[model samples]
Target: MNTQMTYTAFLDEQCLASGPLVDVATAIQQHANQSNATVLIFNDQTGKQIDLDISGSKQDIQQRYAEHPETVKKVGRPKLGVISREITLQQRHWDWLDQQSSSASAVIRKLIDKELNDPNSESNKMLAKQATDRFMSAMLGNMPNYEEATRALYQGNKEVFLDLIRDYPKDIYQHILKLSAYAF
Candidate 1:
């Protein structure tokens, strides 16, 4: 079945409305749902779509961010900002790291790396398993240009992606469109 969703997503100066969506975030979400396959749309004033994880869970969202690390960390209500030096690491996180055979800093780094590595590892499992799973997702089962893809997604340039595939044969384009999880 297909999910139809439309919402008023307000970006710089206008509201874009699209429907039959699962949830309506802010006005930014309207443009996000523009393409039929876009499950998540992030309104970046920076003129880009941030890494995406449609799951909506905080951990999951963070994982998506990991697969695509934002070089320009802009502080705003938008994407639950990255953990900077100013932000204190959670105590429970520290405790979890202590229980495991790793360092808390390492854990955070892994989270970020995983987001940059595997946009699909948006969900977290048990602590240990989550780390390993993220690693594998970013490393193993990765595509020929997974890293490059991650960079493009981070850059949030759909135009570039469009240009890349613009010359593809009809068969290849159809094949790319066949993936249920893929966006434009």
Candidate 2:
């Protein structure tokens, strides 16, 4: 539920629109009204296709797709954007945490932040590869040399991947390159 998340829409292999959900929804609604072309919308962050109800007026579409701020009551410091969740730890782990000067939550947050900030971390690299793969699978699944291009992607052979997809549609080629920039 990331409110700031952006989306990209494609009509066949041609990119149609890309922006916030509301803007994209309106664009899709207008395009859909004018043509019977099939438009696929994707969550940019996860490279996953999403279905949106765009059968309405522009205002209706915008209202329906716009992000509404949540009003849920948080257990921790709401002003600081802290949320509380339950976690189970082993007795030995709890004992060790209890001996630390900082709270266990603070210690855990630091550890997570450290990992998140490390762009070269294995987990981050894997996530980048997975995202690139997902996008490629969706957009280039039927294209020529798809299998070889995918292999090159996972193998971290940027040159080979680029060469394999060199003849793809310009928009798709650029988008694939952008999405897979970190994969290698």
Candidate 3:
């Protein structure tokens, strides 16, 4: 996991902490010591729940969760923030790549960067919707009008979605809006 990534923790419907992993862990530990409520942690960017070992002292927990440098270097230039990964392409695609002046990796990177940088791209919208949906499913599945809100989300009806979830817990409602800002 990236140490720079932010995390959010909730004790049921109430958000307990939202920040870097170490700080969230410390807050969760404190909350756990005081109450028996189950604290669920999530990766803010992906809206995915994650489990962390928070059994020891704050320093110990931080050390345990800290992002460690890879012991073995891989194929790409790690210093330049590049890590090589395998990709499967059809023979015709490989043939076209082989004829290009630039390396296959460079061309692939350009295409990927273009798609990622486009704010109105379908892929970006789909990702935002998925992230929002995942978080809603986990946190507000039982809330009133959840199904309607989900339908409105996929249909790109921001007004109806917001209206449906307006009466929900403030933290969850705000987080949904934040996650789904680009979903439409």
Candidate 4:
């Protein structure tokens, strides 16, 4: 199964359809044909609006995929583009890391990977909030209760945010929920 993430499509500020990412372009096209509406596709995970060109024929798409053969490498360890960087650390922290592993570099890399995978990490939460803020600014800046919604979003008040966006178009409201899902 191709377990791609879901995406929501907005046509003329209303939710037209939402489904697997691959089908979003087709949905947008269909909605546009019916009403001549502007289409925007928002990724559910990242809260970023995506631009897709569904204008090419099947053969063209196939040819394009064929040209980018690196995308289909066999399942195994991929190439690591490692670069060296100087990191200054406190003596106690460096000592602790040295006690944990053979090499300080390995410990540092492991720590970075762990933090990156931790959704509840402070850095990750901040990133999620920033993404939510950007999405709100782009999609709801001119809405009926923009300031209150933005305040609620920053304060991590889901109920207030939901109530504020109650009158928004379905797609916008749902997209906000998806974007701020990690905020609280």
Measured by lDDT, the strongest candidate is: 3
Which pairs of residues collide in candidate 3? none
lDDT of 3: 0.85
lDDT tens digits, residue span 45-143, model 3:
688899988898988988877667766777778766787789999999999999989999999988888887775789888887888888999998887
lDDT of 4 by residue, 1-184 (tens): 1124677777667776777754666665555556765777776666678886656654543454232325445443334534566889899988898798468877887888888777777766666677677777778788789889888877878799789888888767777766676677
| Candidate order by decreasing TM-score | 3, 2, 4, 1
Arranged by lDDT with the best first, the candidates are: 3, 2, 4, 1
- Candidate 3 — which residues are off by over 4 angstroms? 1-4, 99-101
Question: 2 or 4: which has the higher lDDT?
Answer: 2
lDDT by residue for model 2 (1-184), tens: 1225788889988989988999999988888878999999888767788999987688888778887755787677876667788989999999988998999999888887787667667766666678777888898898899999989988888899899999999878877776676667
Candidate of highest TM-score: 3
Instruction: Give the per-residue lDDT of model 1 (tens digit) for 18-137.
Output: 222223332223344554433323221111223333445545434543334466757542275444454465898667778866666667678666764453443211222232223223
lDDT of 4 at 47: 64
* Stretches of candidate 2 exceeding 4 Å from the true structure: 1-4, 74-83, 89-101
lDDT of 3 at 7: 86
Listed in order, each prediction's TM-score against the native is 0.24, 0.83, 0.85, 0.68
Q: Evaluate all candidate structures by whole-model CA lDDT and list the values in order.
A: 0.37, 0.81, 0.85, 0.70
